[model samples]
Target: MPSFYSKKDLFFQLFENQNCLELTQLPYFSDHSKETFTLVLEAAEQIAEKSLYPIFREMDRQEPQLVDGKIRIHPAMGTIIRKFGEDGWINAIFPYEEGGQQLPWVIHLAAGFIFQASNYSASVFPFLTTGAANLIRTFGSKELKEKFTPKMFAGKWQGTMALTEPDAGSSLSDLTTTATPASISGVYRIKGQKIYISAGDHDACENIIHLMLARIEGAPSGTKGISLFVVPKIRLDGAPNDVLTQGIYHKMGYKGAPIAHLMMGSQEECEGYLVGEAHQGLKYMFQMMNEARLGVGMNAVAIATAAFQASLAYAKERPQGRKISEKDLSKPQVPIIEHSDVKRMLLFQKSVTEGALALLIYCGILSDKIAQETSAAKKLKMEALLDLLTPIAKSYPSEMGVKSTSMAVQVLGGAGYTTDFPVEQYFRESRIHPIHEGTTGIHGLDLLGRKVWLQEGLGWKTLQQEIQHSLDQVKSIQELNDLGHSFEEIFLKFNHSAGELLFKRNLGPEKFLADATLFLEASGILCVGWMWIKQAISAQKAISSGALEQSFYLGKIETARYFMEYELVKILGLIPRFHAASYPTVTMEKDWF
Candidate 1:
C-alpha cells in the first residue's frame, strides 16, 4: 500500500515547527509529554494502516443505502467506531474528570489528520461524535450528560449536529424547526425536519443522538427565539422516537458516511431534552460549529495530502516521455517525476498541504492555550486572535485544497482521472469541504464583516503582531532574510488593501461585503504565507544547528520559497481590486443575468 501521509512532516510541524510540547507545560495538560504524544500518534497510524486505508476505496464504492427505513453504512464502521472509543479517541481531548486523558487538542487533531488522510469517509464518524458529545459536555444539563454521554463515549450511540433545514441552510435565523413544551420539566416535543445531516442516521450504532437546533413555539422570531435540544432516535425507554430517517443522499463523494434527511415529531412522539437554556441555541452551537469549521479545513488538507501522495508515488514509478533536451531515439523514457512541470505541480501540492496543515495546527495550539489560560484579559486576546483566524483557517485550505488536489490529478495525467488511481476520489472528496461546515462565501462574510472587527479589531492587530514577530526572528537569519522581507512587503500591501476596504463599510453592507470573498482569499494567502515563513525559519534554524535530516530541512526551505514566490504573490493581484470605488457586482441588476 502506498503511503497516504508523512509522519515525519507531521512530527516536524508538531514538535520542531510549532513546539506543541510547550503545551504540556500547562497544568491542564501537564501529565502528558512528547513520549505519550508519540505513542498516541503511532497508535492512530497503526489503526489507520490496519483498518482505515485498506478499505478507503471500498467504502467509497459501496455508498450507504436507505434499507427498509434504516440507513445502512459500511460494515466496518461499527468496528471502527468501537475501536476509536476503545482506544479513547472520541474523548481523548476532554478533561480527566470526563474520563479522558487530558490530551492536547493539537495532538488529537494531528492524529485525526493521519486517519483522514488514510480514509476521509471512514474518519468522519468518530470526529462528528466527538464534536457532538463535546457540545453536550459543555452545555448540556448534568442529567442530560449522565443519560447520553456514557453511551456516546462508549460508541454504542452516534452523535450528530442537526442544524440545516431545507429552507434554511446557511441562514440559521430563518430556520423554522419548532419545539413545543412537553409534560416533563426539561423535555420538549421536537417537530421539524433537518436535512443534510452527516452521520445523522446510521445503523452502525445502536442509537443516534442528535444535537438539534429548534425554535420554541411561542418564542420571539428569528435567531433570538432559537433553542437547542438533545433529540434521540430511540427514547430512553427503548421505544422508537418520531425521528424518522426520511431519506438518504447519495453524494458524489464522501459516500461512506450517510447524509440523512430526517423528519421529527411526524407522529408527535419525538421527545427532546433541552440543553442548557432556551433562546441560546445558536450561541451554544457555535462551539461545535467553529470546531467543525477547523475540522473541515483539516479534512480538505488531508484529502489533498492523500492525493498528492498517490500522485507522487505514481510519478516516481511511471516512466514517461524523455526530457525536452533529449533528442536520441534510443534513450529510454524517464520517470514522470523527472519533468519540470510535474515537479512544479508536486511542489504546489506540497506547499499547499504542508502550509495549510501548519496553519490548522497553529489554530489547534491557540485552542489549547485558550482552554488553559487563567487570566481573563490574556484569554480574551487569544480568543480574539483565534476568532480572526478561524474563517481564514477554514476557508483557505478548503478553497485551495481543490486546486492542490487538481494538481495531484494533473501530476498523474490520464491515470488520475480514472478509478485506477485514488486521486480522482480525492478530487471528488475535496469538493465537499468548501461547502461543508459553512460555505466559503459564508465564512468570507464571517471573516470580513464580523471577525475582522472583533474586539474593535484586536484580532487583526494580534495577527499583525504575530506575523511581525516571526518576521523579526527570520530577519536575523541570513538564509531566510530575503524571503522574510518579501512576505513582509506583500503582507503590508494586503493589509493596506484591507484597511481601504474596511473604510468603505459606511457605504452599506452590500458594498462592503460584495467582494468579501476576495478579501477572504487574500487573507487566506497571507495567513498561509505567514505559516510558511514560520516553517522556513524553523527549517533554517535546524539546518544551522546541523540537523541530521538535511534533505528534509532543505525541502522545507524550498517549498517555503515556492509558496512565497508563486502562491503568496497572487495576493498582490487582489490588492488592487480591493480599492475599487464603484462595485459592478453590487450594482448589477438581478434581471441582467
Candidate 2:
C-alpha cells in the first residue's frame, strides 16, 4: 500500500484548487503561502509515520487503564504528544502572539487528516486539546486566558471538553451539576459527575484542563441555565483539584484513547472559573461542538481512506478465482483486482472517502472565509449557510464512511473480519464517528427542525444559490454537463420535497419531521454530489492545463462520475418518501415492537 505521505500531492492539489490560499491575504494568515502549507504537512506526515503509525496496534492492544486510581496510557503516547506540542501543531491555527504560526484552518485540518488517518485513537489527544484551547481563547476572560491558554497551546497541559453527564446524556436541560460562589472572584465551587469524557485523565500530560458545563445556583432550568467552567485536575497551588477518575470505559475500538467517568468535587473542593457569562455555557459548548462535529467527520474520512488504500493494495496482490472466460482449471488465477465486483467495491470506497475529504476541507475553507470576511451581511450569510451544512458535513462523511469501510472489508473477504488485518480495526473505529459529536439522528433533527427554517429559511435558500453557482461553473465543461444537469434535476426534486414538508409545519412535530432522517440522508447525498462536481471541474481545469499528474486528475473525474451514477441517483427514489412526511414511526406505539 502507498504510504499516506505518498498521497500528499492529491491532498495539496485539492486544497489549492479550493482556493484555500486566499486566506493568506487576511492579516492573520499573511505570513503563510502554499509552500508554508507544504512544510506543515511534511512535518505532520513525518510525525504520523514515524511515531504514531508504528504503535497503532500496540496502543490498541495495551489500551489505557485506571491503575491505582490514576489513568495510565501507552508509554509512547507521552512522546508523541510532546512532539505534537513542540512541533507547534497544537497551536498551528492560533495567532502568533499566542506562540502559533497563524496558519489557515484549512491547512491545519489538512494536516489533521494526515495525523488522524495514521492513528486516530492516539491522534485524538492533540485534537481535543486544540478544541478546548480554542473555546477558552474565544470566550474566556483575560485572567483565564492569561493563566491557562498559554500552557495549553504550548502543550505543557492537556485540555478536554467535558459536557456529558450520567443522567443528562445529550439533554443539557436535565443536568444537575451545580456551581456556587467561591472565595475568589470569578471562581465557583463546582460539584458534578461527568461521563464518557475523552482524554479526561491520562498520565501523558502534566495537567488536564476540563472545559466543563454545570448549572449555577438560582439559574433557570434547561439549556438556558447551563454555564461553562474551566476545571483543572490540579489547582494553581499544585494541590489536586477535587476531580476523581472513577474508571476508564472500554470501547469497541479506538482503544488507544481513554474515556473516563469523572466525579467532580466529591470532597466539595473543586474550583471552577466561569467562562463568558453565567448562563451561556451551552452556547459556548456549542461552538466547540460544531468544531468537534467536523473533526468527527474528518476522522471518519481518514479511517475509510486508510481502509481503501489497504484493500486496494491487497486486491492487487491477492490472486483469487480464475476469470469467468477461463474454463480450464489449468489456467492461472488472476488478482482479485481483475474482478468487476472488486473494482466496484474499491470505487465505492474511493468515491465516498475522497468526496468526503473534499467536503470537509471545503468546510475548513469556509471557516477561514468567515474569519477574513469583513462584510457583516456576507459573513452572516456564510454563517447561515454553515449552519445548514454542518449536519450534512457531520452526517454524510460519517454515515457513508461506515458503508465505505464495510466495502473495504468486503473486498478483503474473511481476512477483513479478523485481527490479522487492519480493515477490521478501521471498521470498528468508523462505527463511532456517526455516533460522536452528535448522532446521525440528532443532526437529522437539527437540519430539518432548526437550520432549514432559520432566518425565514434564508439558510436553505443561500445553499441553493451556491449549488446553482457550481452548476453554472460546470455548464461549459463538455464532459461534466450531463452530470451537472442531473444534479440540477435532483436538486429541484429536493427543493420541491422540502417545500412540501415546510408546508406541513403546522401539522405538529411528528408530522413535520417523521422522515427527517431520510431527509438528512437525501440532503447528504446532494451535498456530496455538489462537492464531487466541484472536484471534477477542478480536475478538468488541471487536465486542460496539462498538469503532470494526469492519472490522478483523471481518477478524480471518474470517481465523481461513479458517485453521481450509483450514489446520487438514490435521492430520486427517496424524494417521494421525503415529500410523504409519513408519521408511521411516530404513530407506532411503544408496544408495537
Candidate 3:
C-alpha cells in the first residue's frame, strides 16, 4: 500500500518548527521525554497500519445500519476501541493520579494525526470517548467521574457530545431539550431528541455515554438557561435507559462512522446525571467544543495529507505525455511529476497541509503552556492568544482542505474521478470539516463579532506581538530577510484592513458582520503566511547547520516562498471589500434570491 502521510513532515513540525519537546520542561510533564513521545507515535502508527488502514475502504463500502433499534457498525471497531483502551490512549493526556501518563496535549494530537490520516472514520470512536471522559473528569461530581470514566477509559462504553438538536444546530440558546428533577438526587429525567450525533449509537461498546445539553424546567431563557448531563444508553443496573436510536444518517463521505438521530424519553424513563452547576452547561461544553474544533482542523489536514500522498505517488509512477517542447513522437512519455502544472498543484497541497499542521500544533503547544504556566499574567496572555486563534485554526484548514483535496484529484486527472482512487473519497470527507464543530460562517461571525475584541483586545495585541517576534527572528537571517520583509508588508496591510473593520462595529451588528467571512478568509491566509515564514526560518537554519536531508529543507523554503507569493497576495483582493461603503449582502431582500 502507498504511504498515507509524511512522518518526516510530522516530526519536522513537532520538533523543529514548533519545538514541542520544550513542553517537557514543565513540571506537569517532567516525567516524559522526547523518546517517550516518539514511542507513543510509533505505537499509534503500528495500530493504524495494522488495524485501521487495511479496513479503510471496507468500512466506507459497508456503512453502519440501524437494526432492530441498535446501530451495528463494522466488527473491527470493537477491537480497535479495546486496543486503544488497553494501550491507555483514552486517558493518555490526563493526570497521573487519574490513571494517565501526564502526556502533553501536543504529543497526543501528533499521535492522533497518524490514526486520522490512516482511517478517519474509525479514528473518531476513541477520541470522542476521550473528549467525553475529559468533560466528566473536569466538571462532573466525584460520583459521576468514578462511575463513568472507569468504563469509558476501559473502552467498555462509547462517549459522544450530544448537542445538536433538530432546531438548535448552531444556536444553543434555542435548544428545546428539557431536563426535570427526578426522585433521586443529582439525577434528572431527560426528555428531548438529538440529531447528527457522532458515535452516538454504535454497537462497538457495551454502552453509549452522551455528554448532553438540556434546559432545566423553569430555568432562565437563552444561553444562561442551558445545562449539561451525562445520559447513558444503559443504566448502571444493567437495564435499558429508554434512549432510542431513531435512525442513522447516510452521508456523502465518512460513511464508516454513523451519525445518529435519537429520541431520549419516548417511554418517559430516560435518566440523566447532572454535570457541574445547573444552568452552566454551555460554559462547560465550550471546553470540549474548543478542543474538538482544533481536532476538526487536524482532521482536515490529515485527510488532505492522505489525498496528497496518493496523488504524489501516482504522479511519480504514472508516466504521461511528454513536455510541450517535445516534437519527437517516438520519445517515451515522462512521469506527470515532470510537468510544471502538476508540480504547482502538488506544492499547493503541501503548503496548505503542512502550514495548517504547523498552526494547529502551535495552538496545541499553547494549550499545554496554559495548563502548566506558573505566572498568572503569562497564563492569561496565553489564554487570550489561544482564544484569538481558535476560530482561525478551526476554519482555515477546514475550508482550504477541500480545495487541497480537490487539487489532489486534479493531479490524478480522470483516475481521481473514479473509485479506483481515494482522492475522491477524500474530497467528500473534506466537505464535512467546514460544517463540523461549527460552520465556517458561524466561526466567521464569532471571530469578527466576538474573538477579535475579547478581553479588551488583549488577544489581538498578543497575536501581533507574537507575529512580530517571528518576523524579527527571520529578518536576522540574511537568506530569509526578503521573505520576512514581504510578510511584514502584508501583515501590516491585513492589520490596517482589520482595524477598519473593527471601527465599523459602531455601525450595527449586521453592518459589522456583513463581510465577516471575507475577513476570516483573509485572516486565515495571513496566519498561514506567518506559519510559513516561521517554517522558512527553521529550514534555513537547518540548512546552515548542515542538515542531512537537503532537499526536504529546501522544499520547506520553496513552499514558504510559494505561499508568500501566491497565497498571501490574495489578501489584497479582500482589503478593498472592507472599505466599501455600500452593504448589499446585508440589505438585499430575501425574495430577490
Candidate 4:
C-alpha cells in the first residue's frame, strides 16, 4: 500500500468520513473543525513551502537590524509579513463579529505548524501581533476595539505584548514601567522601557500597537498594581514621529523577527488606552499570555515536524553506511538510515514530533469548545481544564522540541551541525520558546503549585477521567493490550505518588518542587499516550476492514505502540528521578557547580 502524508481519506474515516471532526465520537476533537483545519493546513503548507522555507537561511544570516534609528528586517521580509496578514492567515480564530474569519482555534494552530516550521523567525511577526490583538478583542472597550481592531485585523498595523522590563524578566511583579493619566481623550501616557519584545517594531505595517504593562498612581505594589495599555508607534493621522528605536537585538536564532528594546513616552507624551480595568491588567493580560503560551507550544510542534521531515529525507537519500545484514566489505555503503542507531534517532524524532502535534492540535480544538458550546456550565468546566492544560501544552513541546530538532541535526552528521543546514538553526530557534512566554520551571510550578490544586481539585479529576476513558479503549485493542495494561498500572502509581507528595509535605514547598518538573513530564507523556491510543483505535477499524491503506494504518499503530511501550514505560524511571532520597541538585549547593 502507498504511504500518504496528507491522509485525507484516513482522517475522514477516523471522524467517520464526516466533513468536520466529531467531538461526540472522539471527545478530544471538537466538532465541525476537521475540514476547515484541513483546508487551512493545506493553505499554510503552500505558503510555508513557497515563501517561508526558502527565506529561513537568509533571514538567519541577515537577522533584524537598526538602520538609521529604524527597525529593519531582511528587505524581502517586509513583503512576506504583510502578505501573511493580508491573507487573513493572522486573523484565523478571532470573532467573526470583529471582521475575523471566525475559524476554530484548532484549525488556526494546526495550520500554524506549517508556517512556523517553514520559517520560524519570519512567523513570529504575525504570531505576536495576533497575541496583542487577542488582548484587545477579548478585553478592550468597544471604542478601543473600533479604533484598533480594523487596522490590526486588516494588517495595516502590527501588534505586540510588552510585559518584560529590563528589571523584570520572568518575575513580572518587579516591573517599574509607569502609566499616568493623559491629556488626550480616553488615553493614558505610557513612559517605560520594554526589553525583549518580539515584533516590537517593524516596517511591515503602518503602525505598531504595543500592549504594555505599567503601574498607575496610588496602585498597589507588585503584579497586582499593573495595568495594560495600548501604545502605538505612529502618531494619529499617519504622521511619523520620532519614536524611540532604542535598539534591536541580534539573537542566537529566529533572526527574521526583530526583538526590540523599545522606550515609549520618552518624548512628548506617548498616547495609550486602558485595556480591561485599572489594577486588573495582569489578570486580563493573562488571556493573551495564555493564548500565546499555547501558540508557543504549537509553534514548537511545527518546527519539530519540519526538522524531522528534513532529516528523515536527508537520511534516506544520503548514503553513508552498509546495511547490517550485508556481509560484503567491498561493496559501496548503503544509506545512513540502514544503521540501527540512526533509525532509532529518526524514530525518536518522529514519535516526539507526532505526539506533540497531536496533543497541541487537540488542545486547539478544546479551545473551540470553550467558546462555541453555548453551555455556560460546560464552558466554565472546559475553561478550567484548558487553563490547567495550557502550561503543559506550552512547556512540554519546548522541552521535547529541542530534543527532536537536535536529533534531526545528528541524523545529518557533521553537515547538520553547521549553518549550512536548517536543522541547527531549528535547534537554536526552538530554544527561545520555553523561555519566552514563561520558563519551564515557572510552568512546572503553575502546574504543581496552582493548577493541580485549583477549584478543589476539579481540573485534576477531569484529566484523570479522560485518562481512564482512553485506557479503557486501549484494553479492547488486541495489539495494544499489554502496553495498555502497563500504562494503567503506571498511571495508578502516579496517583499514589501524588498522594505521597502531599501527605509527606515535611520539606519546604520549594524542595517539593524538585520532582515537580518530572511530574509535568510524566503527565505530558500520559496525555500523549492517551492520544496515541485514540489514533491507534481509529486506525485499527479501518486497517482491519481494508477501508484504509495498510501502510498508513500500520504506521499509526506502530507509533502508538511506541508511545505506550517507551513513553508510558517511562513513568517507572521518572518516579525514581522525582522522589530521590538526596538531591544532587540541592544537597551540593552552588559551590558544586
Model 2 has an lDDT value of: 0.87
**Would you give me the overall lDDT of model 4?**
0.76
List candidate 4 segments past 4 Å from native: 1-20, 23-37, 239-243, 504-506, 581-593
In candidate 4, list every pair of residues with a backbone clash: 12-17, 321-334
Tens-digit lDDT string for candidate 4 (1-593)? 11112334224323442223644344433333646556667787777777877777898888777888778777776687678778887776765566667666666665666677778887777777788888887888988888887777677788888888888988988899887887766577777799988888877678888888889877999989999888888766676443487998888878788889988777756777888889989998888888889989978877787788778888888988588788899999888888989878887887787777677766776776676677887887777788888888898888888888899899998999887767898888878887879988889888987898888777888888877988888788897687678778878988887767654347877667776777888778777777777777777777878874688778777877677776678877877665566766567768667
How far is each candidate from the true structure, as Cα RMSD in Å?
A: 0.9, 1.5, 0.8, 3.3
Ranking by lDDT: 3, 1, 2, 4
Q: List, in order, the clash count of every candidate structure.
A: 0, 0, 0, 2
Deviation (Å) of 12 in candidate 4: 8.0
lDDT of 2 by residue, 438-463 (tens): 88988988999999988888889999
lDDT, model 3? 0.94
Backbone clash pairs in model 4 (N, Cα, C under 3 Å; residues 3+ apart or in different chains), count: 2
Candidate 1 weakest lDDT stretch, 10 residues: 490-499
Poorest stretch of ten by lDDT in candidate 2: 1-10
TM-score of each: 0.99, 0.97, 0.99, 0.92
User: Could you tell me how far off, in angstroms, the CA of residue 187 lies in candidate 1 after the best superposition?
Assistant: 0.9
Compose the digit string of candidate 1's lDDT tens values, residues 193-239: 99999999998999999999999988988888999999999999999
For model 1, which pairs clash?
none
**Please, what is the whole-model Cα lDDT of each candidate in the order they appear?**
0.93, 0.87, 0.94, 0.76
Kindly report which residue stretches of model 1 are placed more than 4 angstroms away from their true locations once superposed. none
